[model samples]
Target: MQRIRAFRARSTPDRPAPLRRAAAPAVAALALLLPATLSGCAAFGGERSGIVVTTNILGDITRSVVGDEADVTVLMQPNANPHSFGVSAQQAAELEEAELLVYNGLGLEEGVLRNVEAAEQAGTPSLEVAAGIDPLDFAEGESAGQPDPHFWTDPVRTGEAVDLIADAIVEQVGGIDEDRVRASADEYRGEVEALHAEAEERFAALPEERRKLVTDHHVFGYLADRYGFEVIGAVVPSGTTLASPSSADLKSLSDAVRDAGVPAVFADSAQPDRLTRVMAEEADLEIEVVPLFTESLTGEDGDAPTYLDMARYNTGAIADALAE
Candidate 1:
């Protein structure tokens, strides 16, 4: 039996007090130069009047579909864990005022879900990208039977999301060229579809017995379902990274890993690889811990700055690791 972290919260980086102090004088000076409302907005996160997306991956897709049609504001920073990232007061205000609020629904953005709900209540034209696509539930985990919100793992579904987001932008956002939006979406969708084909070809070369995955968590279910891979186990046997694994969970996963003989355990790049390393040792087998950009995108300098890049990178990494 696996024990789950019912109330665990993932730790996030905190700003130093010295930095805050340094910024205070600049903020005060800027406040004096701006109007009261705008000053308040600047204090939080700057007001965004255009499309506001919760996750960076969805933000990238939205930007592709929008293509200079409108301003797109992404709340989640690069390489930040979606399960634990939060919004500032001004960003929350911006969500309510957004022309279109795009988010990954079905509980992926655990920290800002209430803000999304509030934005919905405030009548912000919203689109839940994950739910629109056919979402799958956890087959086995503490979150079993709940809809998996990581549908973006499957490029096919992400292509579908492009269409949905484009349609919403055309219907909801005011003063935008619908034709341009549609055209941009079509172009981006083609790229995403191409990514799916690339992934299929890349993964097809692996032997059937090697098409098994053990990960930091149950984040690759959609990818596994799409690519015919089996997710034998995960270090954290839950859908969200916020959940922690107990001694029984580690032992159970290690036992499964030993039995399955998978060559690698994939950990999210946004997360620390400590637990994954521990699990590998517990397996008592020489297993490699491969870091994958599973939950978030990285900065421009990083390997996975875009959705297409992220998928391609993960596909190659998994294939290479398993082949060895």
Candidate 2:
């Protein structure tokens, strides 16, 4: 439920290309190209509405659309690293009952891929949100445009994802309140659009040179694409947070950060800051860890409990911090 309050991404007049200094670092550049892990199933919220999402990010949005109509049992648990997630027997059993299974396709949930494959065999319909969004092409020799599944990083794209995902849910799941669900989706979509507009307005005010983003990984590709920002590189040099980073990748990213004159490195607040800290410490640069929302959403008590809330919180954070 943690919310990002420091960083804002907005479209601007001048956009700069990423600095191409060296060949691909030795890290598994292809790994970051892969999507997150997946889950088998679960006894979610003590009631089974037959709708289950693979990740908390999708589950949160689904809950908003389904409301009391369905009880969403999220497969992945809180604080459980989804990149290297493991499924359980109970979770596997839940998939058998799912009429609609929502997930971010495009190789996210790699570990969960096997489970999703199994779920498909069990006759459960899996919906990948990244199915329609414009994808990013990987660097030459990187994982060939496998299409990053982290579209939720960009609020506009996430809004699009929600609209599409909600429709699939209504059409696939039986007895859902169509008027309620569609209206909820439209209302949420309007909020997301507003958040994007506000972010653009706020972030566009930053100095041109400050439009660079350095992070633990290239998760912000969608955000950078939505607004005008250059992704300098990442500490992991891969896609999923489940992978490990090498000392060489650290030095390289730190060098890139200093070279790019970026004031900060973006990190996910939902996860610990050990790696960003290490990267900052090693880089010996004035790097601030701009904690943000990624992968999972917050609970009802959390700051970003829903997709729209996450976008608004992140937009405000990025706008305020970058404007500084």
Candidate 3:
């Protein structure tokens, strides 16, 4: 078990010098124009109710735990990439006024972390869900040794996160029924455990030799670790989609896929799978490129509309793709 840090509702450290310098002018301009822009648009007029979440996955989980106790406003839209999705100025302001802000901290929401930090600086308590869960480190490449932010890939870890998130909501969000929130958390955790068991059983049916995963990026360290799959390689070889794959990286990944006889290369449905496609072509093998809901949830009508749906869909897809 990873050492769980006590949850702190404090501001994060200042942005790097270069980023601060680059943002200073924009910050100044926004400061000058914000008041007028906000006034005309009523950006700050509405009653700021409920918990604000930075990512859709966390938003869905928070909603489950909070139930009708509080309105949960998720900043990231359905089928969006957390690393690169930016919040609007109005949404940023809303974060500052929210009862509590929940984010997947460990550098997952690169685009929104600054806004979360700003919200914390303005006195809104922020919860980093990853802080409470034992996080996996990247096994190799540039991201090795860094805490993996994609803990939701492991259902067991996510079940633990439900406990942490429920506690935070009960303790931080005022006027909520503590008993109700705790009950909801327990209920959700049971569901998560069931999901974990089902996924484990499905994966267990897969032959050990066939339990190899090659993805668009290194997004499945936890999933592979939990289910006994070997991560053959990834096109980008990094944790975040923001990183691009070099020619050498692509070549190596293509070779690995061919060598491992991987039947499918999985990519995030929220992202363009161009790189994965290109790698498939480069490998010159009859391999399938399967898209999974790895990073974000889709709209309500789509396949992965909720957290549990996303996990189940991905698990079934993996089983179908690899257990052949």
List ranges where model 3 is wrong by over 4 Å. Answer: 1-49
User: CA lDDT of each candidate?
Assistant: 0.81, 0.67, 0.80
In lDDT terms, how accurate is model 3? 0.80
Question: C-alpha displacement of 239 in model 1, angstroms?
Answer: 0.5
Write down the TM-score for model 3: 0.85
Each prediction's TM-score against the native?
Answer: 0.85, 0.79, 0.85
Query: In model 2, which runs have C-alpha deviations exceeding 4 angstroms?
Result: 1-49, 138-144
By lDDT rank, best first, the candidates go 1, 3, 2
Q: Can you write out model 1's per-residue Cα lDDT over 138-239, one digit (the tens) per residue? A: 888898877888998899999989988887787667678999999999999999999999999999999999999999999999999999999998888899
Clashes of 1: 0
lDDT (10s digit) by residue, model 3, range 81-119: 888999899999988787677888888989988787677
lDDT of 2 by residue, 1-324 (tens): 221111111213222111111122421242223221211222233333478788877887778777777668888776455676667878877765676678766667777777765665554545666755565744311333446667887777878777777766665566678888888888877877777888788778877787877767667778888788877887777777766788887888888777777777778787888988998888787767888776667667877776667777777777666666
